[model samples]
Target chain A: MTPIALADYDVVYRRPDALTDVQTHYCPGCTHGLIHRLIGEVIDELGIRENTICVAPVGCAVFAYNYFNVDGCEAPHGRAPAMATGIKRVIPDRVVFTYQGDGDLAAIGTNEIIHAAGRGEDLTVIFVNNANYGMTGGQMAPTTLAGQVTTSSPYGRDVDLVGMPMRVAELISTIPGASYVVRRSVHNVANINKTKAAIKTAFQVQMAGLGLSMVEVLSSCPTNWHMSADGALKWIEDAMIPVYPLGDYRVADAVEPLTKRRRPDRSQNGSLATIPEE
Target chain B: MAKELWKGNEAIAEAALRAGVEAYFGYPITPQTELLEYMAREIPKYPGRVFLQAESELAAVNMVYGAACAGVRVLSSSSSPGISLMTEGLSYIAGTEVPAVLVDIMRGGPGLGNIMPSQGDYFQMTKALGHGDFHPIVLAPSTVQEAVDLTYGAFELAETYRTVVVILADGAIGQMMEPVVMPPARPVMTEQERADWALRGAKDRERRILTSLHLSAEGLERMNQGLQNKLARIQQKELRWQETMTDDADLLLVAFGTAGRVCTSVVSAARRAGLKVGLLRPISLWPFPEQRLVELAERVQQILVVEMNAGQMVLDVKAAVAGRAPVHFYGRMGGVVPLPDEISAQIDKLVSEPAGGTGFKTGSNNGYGQPKAMPAANGVRA
Candidate 1:
């Protein structure tokens, strides 16, 4: 019953030092917590946790600042990319990233993200696509899957009226300024491990002073999706992958060397993860 | 420093550099494009400086908000429509209590009025710059030298109050060339200095969070109360004004920016014509020179408020005068500039009238509006 009463017990795992001890307000089965952990781990691995600035967007992850033990700025809806650009430009020595969700990125902030990637701002973007506006109570998002049911799309999203969902990774990859653009999911352990690698690679590209690097993670929102925790994870693999198509949308010439091979002595967590060749 | 003929917009850009502006973010807008151009060309010359031409006013202002949150000296310049798009970011910056300098080189408009200089943004600048219970420190410069001077001092004021400082100039001041003795460059904010409130990183310290959002009522109200207290301190200590012939005067003319520039001549011509007239030009428009105006209102006969817009600042003048003196408004709408003679005629009417008459509202104000069309200018149509 007293699990940790024995101080002599071995500590198998610990929260990444980049993350604060505060409990997240994320709902059960919400993968924002998972994404935050992956980012924290990446920062902890890169040893840039102290020199990293996080830009928080207006969404479920608006308080991402509270969970991250780094300097942070809470940007307006859809404005995180611009804020990241601002931070990176002013403090180029510091690592900067933006944590944005579907409504914050695909819908309201399309302009800022597009231009940020277009200009090749030396910043990292962790965009979480959950197919709905999670914080705003499951409204139809720009990334809302076609024919998906939601509050705003009560009769399901009609492609004729609202148009097709935006594939942000593919769109951003077309910009010459974007050095690394990819989409990954957290539906299962394999994909979760891959998503963590992609997140780490993004920070690596930024650290290398390459260009705008974005890792769009397909996250699960069980509460908003009106599904059980297990069902939301399964839905990403069954329904989300077909539309999103997890793949490397863009890898600039300079980034290939870093991506193609795993550095010899990496993975302090003891999991040698690899990007899905697909 | 030797005086050199510098264009207003360019003077502002150089002044920003002298103030050691760390970043410049803006979109190209008429009468203020030179400022952005100058930055684009020169920001790179400095070892580590930033110059970004944002996609739109909305994007530009947000970039400004981002840079401001970093606790650096940043600048943005735009005319009316562009400034309108910036309202959202300005509000967030105000709530966040960050320092930023905005130079609003006013052209004309409630709409696409003209490229002609007009003080139409008086209400927009001094009153509702952005929504919320907040106010920006507004400095309206009357000439190019003054514009440079204000641009030099604005950053300090903004950082001092941790608020936005808007250097309000019009197209005339922005476009015209004037002799300016530029101030030497002040040292840029050091990293140690910025660590006080900037969001650079959490190195060797607790993380810093700069956010305006407070979901709970108590939290937001406390922030608002703090903002109000800061504004009160600004209003008390930062009221600036320039008065001439007010030592013994019957009629005092109230105006700012270009209106104030022209009224100086109007007052001189009126005085030459045997009238005891003075000009009370307000330099700091937000703190508003209200107390000074109220004090002067006690001695003056009828306070005449002159502007290039349709009676905006007169409202504040009236509120401050509070019937201590009767306030009459003389303004030219549709981006029309009120000539000295036109203002003098209005003053003549006010002086000749025995007691009470809405002296300048008799449709004759449109006289200036009729001839507003020029080859390069907009607004007047055939």
Candidate 2:
């Protein structure tokens, strides 16, 4: 029998089932969904769906737990890093990560993030940098550009008072324990692919037990940026990328396989058992 | 039988070890410093137990916070000023209902109060020590034996109520030495027992979160109400006190912790002097022995309250008595502990007076009624 030739094959390019069907709380043209998709694809590909633990930050993505199908915890404002530390320490075998925005990671939580990286904790962090605080209606952020205007800075950010925008990828790259640090963007198809690669690499570094890894994604917030979705994409490409160049800030040439080496089992060694009462 | 002569602080450490404590995180401070020192030496000797000498009181408490969030048995101990520094962490633990134990070996307070024995932290322990509407289960131990027994009790109550349990003692009790029969060893939890909610290496389960903050007003109110309900259950089941000869006494000595020990001697002396005196010793300071005091108030004409501070527990005693009988108070401040003879003298004065007349009573014909008793000769026998 001759095989029948079909002219068309049906396929849908919609949201993943792991993602909620409800409308997003994010502004139109915001790159949060694109980043979410990249993370979801990686989670699905790595077969870590059941064991992965995510700490949601207190920002635009505070309700991220509702959208992600994996286990998630909502942390206090600027405390996602510390919360992630707690989760990772107690469950060292679990693949734990924190998703944070510029305001949540760079300002109030700077100490927590710095300490976690310094300690070389085995965890991953996904930092979304939109140059402003989105959920609080576009206030100034630690990453807001020199001349950008926000609700708190009506005359635009003054370099003298607030200082220049921080380059977090570059900053974290200097940390000795940071196994992998990269900066990526989500403006277009080409950049989206690069961001996905960066996220995958960061997770792979964590799985390898190299230590702390982070991916900083430059995203767009069109409503807060006072632009249309297309305009916001254009603005991110034209204005944001120049100041925050995207690339791997620090990458290890080769990492030891995490599975090859077995961690000392404190339990098997009779370390965690109760001692006789004195 | 595990019998040993132990310092009050060391006995507490031994009790915690026997109770299957998983970790001990602490900073050194006077009086209670032995507790941490002993833990630092002993905990490491036990294969599974961890003992950390933290960078500061802040760090010690946070380390405890970390261990507690992981749903393990952890403890921290300090003196008065150190406990003040721990209030922030304690508040978080209480607000989040993390099960843990804190031992406060009380010293003088209000500022850099002396490191000698004083009950100045009575209010801080029984009342909310931190900034919020939260209360910890406060246990006051009068003797070294009680120190061991109550510490064990604190851990059990903490897990049962899912709240912070405080063993509130003074320098005298914390530093004093006595014989103790240690408790039997507790069995470690099986993997299945802790696998449900513990954060241990998240395997094939949802992430667990431990936090105290709730953004919404209604959410916070609900949390507060839930905590109150738990506390009510504790009150019904955990209220503890000791009564001696209150059945047919004209005078009752109400005290707690080290003060109760001193009051015992005073009661004996008052009895010998032909004054019917008994003692009401409170073990639990939070669910306080209020009902017991009220019941005693009906039989006794006067209740003499002794403490090592400036009238903190006296307020609770007054509230318990409710004016049915006079509540007389004798206290010393700045780490000066009143002796048994001084307390006995105070008892004599109260018993000789009319019913419903306190030392602090105003406009009394007796010159130096309250203020006169203040600078009494140090009545400790040479």
Candidate 3:
């Protein structure tokens, strides 16, 4: 094989140590690569590479740990939140987050995420809503559009049997402990920038010691949708985006103001010898 | 500190508290109710301890599941029927390899049998308690001290092996008061110890995931093999039991937990009557004291299996002996506790009779025949 110039590495834009050397199994022009790049950029920007831990769920993102240049653990289907809870409880100082697909996060891990949010566990969740279970051959996800067809829902998702698509960002906003919950898309350059901003905000909320924060990214699976990359972008804008509208559901401005208080250091105890004799 | 008077159930609760258990999730069940009650009353007195009264046994087990998933030392206690309800959660915990403690202060059971003491759940406990292939490290405490000691040991073992550990006792043991020396306090991991994996309010780091599902067949098989390897190592290193008066005795008595304590009395009484009888009390139900019994079976002419149920552990004893010695079973079930005097009387009857006399053969090769066709006068199986 011809050795490529180091300057060509900028095209992939991955960390030197990041383990995505092998080509991804994603279809041509799929946006999973873009989202992965954005998340990697956020980790690098925050300087949390050493102390950060990523939870990979059982989906297309199951190999998420491989792409992130940090420690990671894989969770069973839809159980990333629960597993993240375990990891966080033991390693409380480290930043923890779950990278999950729509099917894994919305369909199976609904209870785990809901309860974790309700309990105000300090963790970040990166929810990728592609409207289908992209990994296991295309199948309808909980976030699937009403008329979207997949392997499992050949006649398109029938609301009567499968129920209406879940609005995760809206649902999570109802949780009292959720300090930040936002839904952004990754179809176009503008939306991808917005999605990265939302992810960064979620991490900032956790860093501010606020509470549970989640960023739901409306993504595309072109091959699964049997559409070209450009067609998939239009499909998300015309179909997926309407059902799963993108916006910030909850963001606490009070957190920054509240954390600004100057507190006295009690560790020195006034040098102990300076204590006045009563 | 020397021994202090304590109830077995209270000791289990206190030991758990001292072991830095982060949470206690349980419902009230007779005999074992004291364990949960103690936790409720005492857990709050200590900082960092959480106690929750779940809606049902099912809820209690699931709550433990939730807390244990958080990598916290969580525990639950129940009797037979309650344990049956928690079996589903236990199977999940085992499947996920979540470390937690489950205390079963046993009572008589096939259904809601009785609230009194019984060892009937031996098979349900020692064998797989739920569907699918898995076993929890089962600790059977014969004394109040062991109950407390084993509760501490269970937590450590559970964490070490990444599996559930069951502290199996009976109503009599749970309720009975005895002198126990409390374990000294050990250093519990502070927030620093858990900073690597614990989800203490997420900081600016990466996310962590903990789970047990293997989607591929190859992944599942690898997980199962890993668990089996851990179990095999535990069986080799953690199996424990106690043998009393076995060297000179002609008859060996095999029992566990409360049944073993009862057998002690029977052995003492038989010895006073000049009948040579010994007792084998198993401390760990799983990785059972089979080899010890196999060794004892070689010397003893006959073995008497005593329990508070219809021959559950007897089958294990029989399996261990493998016809090396004639194994006889005598038990009481349905909340009917057999008195030590009655067990002694049965032992006396066996000792007084000559080999092959009284229609009961006394040889290693003797088959497990019908129970003499004797009348079930005492509500016990003949």
Which one wins on lDDT? 1
The better-scoring model by TM-score among 1 and 2 is 1
Model 1 chain B weakest 10-residue run by lDDT: B371-380
Residue lDDT tens for model 3, B162-266: 788999999988999999999986555565655244333334554444445566899999989988998899888888998889997788888888778888888
TM-score of model 2's chain A = 0.86
Query: A1-278, model 1: which lDDT tens digit per residue?
Result: 65667588555457989999999999998999989999998898789988999999999999999999999889988988887777788878899999999999999999999999889999999999999999989999989999999999999999999999999999999999999999999999878888888898999999999999999999999999999999999999999999999999999999997687653234445544444453
Q: By the lDDT metric, which is better: model 1 or model 2?
A: 1
lDDT of each candidate versus the true structure: 0.87, 0.78, 0.77
> Who is ahead in TM-score, 1 or 3?
1
Show where candidate 1 strays beyond 4 Å.
A1-10, A263-267, A270-278, B362-382
Q: Tell me the tens digit of each residue's lDDT in model 3 across A113-158.
A: 8877886768999988888999888998888888789999999889
Candidate 2 overall lDDT versus native:
0.78
For model 3, how big is the iRMS in angstroms?
Answer: 6.1
Total clashes, candidate 3?
27
TM-score of 3: 0.75
